[model samples]
Target: MGRWEPDARGRLLRAALELFAEHGYEATTTAQIADRAGLTKTTLFRLFADKREIVFQGQGELLALVTRGVDEALNDASAWDRMVNGVLVLSGAHAHEHRTTGRILDPILARSPELNERAVFKRSAITSALEGSLIGHGIDRWQAGALADLGIRAYYSGYDLWVAVDDSSTLADHVLAQITVLRGAAAQALEAAAPQPHPAGVRSADG
Candidate 1:
């Protein structure tokens, strides 16, 4: 193998995914991934902290993008509006480029509990970051948290749909559509849970 290589990080990530798929996450080793990429173990470690990190590359960038989007929204914007802006920011930047890898990653994470846990942790971290940003903008904590959860769910669900479905829409389009769906669902749930008024002539059994 050459001492210098182009796209080493990309190579390592693809190699790791392939090995994890073939032999399973726990069964695959860093050295095997490195070898599969035609790179050295030292090169792999230089690119990633460990075998697990390879699968989660770009998490930091996404979190930063999410924070930026929410923070930059108009001061008077509603929490849900700010969340939609955040989803648009991140998904527009990353979704198209990541579609191919996302397709491969979804099933691999589904098969591996450890990898899926890490994926969930990364998402939770993004949600927390978004909530903090909303609070910084003077939004109420409860509303901030709820909007954060909904925002993250919308972004990811949109990404999943983008990867699974053959569509002409961009990731931001998919994410925005999902946000609309989630908002409608939340509305229905609240309406269903609301107490209905009793008829004027109705009497309780206790009464």
Candidate 2:
């Protein structure tokens, strides 16, 4: 192996995923990942904080995309539009490319409590960034938070389905589909919960 491989960071990430899937996330070590990548542990450490960081290497880029999407949304856009736009940006930025990695990481996450917790934390951070960006765009804080949460839910639900299914649709398409479904469901639930009006020309029993 050459001392300087092209795309060393990518090589490290792929190597880590392979190791994690083969030996479980909790069982894999930074040294093993480095060795698998044909790089020294120092090289791996330089590229990533640790083994866990390797799985979440795309976190910063995804969050940045969401922030930029929300910031650039039209001032008059609805909260749902702003939130969906951010999610679409994130999906477009890395969804297809990260799908395989996500598939590989999913089982590992399910087997490890620490990694699962970290994954949840990363998701929360992404939602926080989305909410902050929406708030900066003049949306109410509460609405922004709710929109961000819904966006995150849509993204994850879509990503999971996309990875699990044998479909050709892009990640952005899957996310949009999930968002539409979620919106419809929410509307249905709200309608079901709303108070029914009295019959025409008739008063309610209490009235």
Query: Which tens-of-lDDT digit does each residue in 1-207 have in candidate 2?
Result: 674878888888888889888888878889888888889998888878888888778788888999988877788888878898899998888646677777787888899898888999999999999999999888899989888988999998988988887667888888899999988998999899999987799998887
- By summed lDDT, the worst window of 10 consecutive residues in model 1 runs over 90-99
C-alpha RMSD between model 2 and the true structure: 1.8
Model 2: per-residue Cα lDDT at residue 72: 70
Q: Which pairs of residues collide in candidate 1?
A: none
lDDT of 1 by residue, 150-193 (tens): 98899889888889876677888888999999999999999999
| Cα RMSD, each candidate | 1.8, 1.8
How many residue pairs clash in all the candidates, one count each? 0, 0
lDDT of 2: 0.86
Residue 104 C-alpha lDDT in model 2? 81
Task: For residue 45, give model 1's deviation from the true position in Å.
Answer: 1.6
**Local distance difference test, candidate 1:** 0.86
